[model samples]
Target: MNVKQEHLKETNPEHEILDILKNRWSPRAFSDKKITEKEVKILLEAGRWAPSAFNVQPWRIIWGIKGTETYDRLYNCLDEFNQSWADNAQVLMAGAFKKTKEGDKENFHALHDLGLFMANVYTQAHSMGIATHQMAGIDFKKAQKEFKIPEDFHVATGIALGYYGGDASVLPEDLQEKENKQKRERKPQSEFAFNGNFQNKN
Candidate 1:
């Protein structure tokens, strides 16, 4: 089925924005098409170049494409709820941060830096007609051990990537309705972007 994503776009923004930003939205269903190794590298390279405090470059991603052993291992690390939907994704990733690559001192900003890295990955992938859905619902400890992540690093998130797939019928009735009709919602800039006093603007 040809799924229409234009309807999924956010309604009129307060201001204009890039198509990449406008088009980026996560969906539970994914096509079985495999992402090429070169395309995978592009996603990683975008994340690798994201800015970090003192240039620590703390983000780390362990990924595997569908039908590979690595992919199986990564998928097993997801919680049951995520596995139900993410199984259709062509690529799965374990995202982590090296807590202190520079020295023994803790890098307080490592998690925040990972967010920047993920944003870059999302943008780059969208540009290539790939969709990525980041998930907080993961078996972090399982991923850490399965991926052999070192003690210095902390597992943070998981990602499922692939070409878009699924129709509302593909999901359970409860989710199908949501899948077919949910609109993207976000707090207004005034609610979070403060000017001086950090209070909600009218």
Candidate 2:
């Protein structure tokens, strides 16, 4: 099932915000289709353009695609269950951040900047007709050691990206059941954001 971007594009993008937003949900289910290296390079390039503190560009993308050393190294770092669903993904991307540029500055602002990079990864991929999923369910410390990441680099998260498969074979049965759960139920904006100061109500 080659799920191209056109089949996934929900809205006409002609003043239809809901159409786009409504279709933008993370899917753990990914197809076995091969994503081109060109697309991978372009997506990472988008991430490279993310805003960083003092132009340090602290983000690094360590990736494993199908049959490479990276595949084994990253798979071994996952926490069992994640390796189940994520293993089927076309690409396993590790988002790493540099603690400091030139090994100086008490506050390197890597975490803050890495966040901006991840945003670019998902949104840009979406616009390009690609689907991506960011995963936090991995042993970060183990990944750092396995990937030969330097002392200055911190493994922030793992991301599984590619086309999404539509069957339960691509995901665990329990997770598939939750696939269509409403976004509002996941996190209401009121709980995550406030009007001004600390307000108890949403």
Candidate 3:
């Protein structure tokens, strides 16, 4: 299940290197295929290498394998809406960012920097034949309390990573259609980016 970066390209790649930029997305269906700890470490190592402002690495990850006690606790904390889709994941992770680094004043781009690192995690997992779907619609306050997190750390998102699951009928009707399609669709690049001037288009 080695997903070549080229195979994931939305369009042709003279536009961009498939591995560098491609159809990275979130999906609710997970194959319940447990990834080895070594592979998980490899994914995080990719995150550790992400660039940061003044080299301030503000990201922190709390993870657990499916069926573990820790995983149970973390899983229980999610809203039921997420639980239905996420319980099938082979691996679940809680993300947070240390707002203040020692000898520093400002919070540093805690959330933003964490986001960059998470991108690395996502891409690395994708290249490894793992699919990751992130959930921000989670209980941040509860995660902070349960994980015994420091006051400066802000819970960011929960992630579900594993292989793709079987069918779309497992999902709610609306989502079933999207899952069945299995194609990348977006509003339009111009709607989100501009070449210096803001010419809004969708």
lDDT of 2 at 181: 46
In candidate 3, what are the lDDT values of residues 37-140, reduced to their tens digit? 89889999999999887788988899888889878878977888888767778888998988887676777577888889989998888777888888886698
- After superposition, the stretches of candidate 3 with alpha carbons farther than 4 Å from their true spots are 4-14, 102-104, 197-202
Position 168, candidate 3: lDDT: 51
Per-residue accuracy of model 2 over 22-129 as CA lDDT, tens digit each: 455567776667877888888888888988888888888888787778877887887887887877777888888888766576545888898899888777777765
Best by TM-score: 1
Whole-model Cα lDDT of every candidate shown, in order: 0.82, 0.73, 0.77
Candidate 2 minimal-lDDT segment of 10 residues: 6-15
TM-score of each: 0.91, 0.82, 0.85
TM-score, cand. 1: 0.91
Clashing pairs in 2: none
Candidate 3 global TM-score:
0.85
Q: Which 10-residue window of candidate 1 scores lowest in summed lDDT?
A: 1-10
- State how far residue 184 of model 3 sits from its true place (Å): 1.5
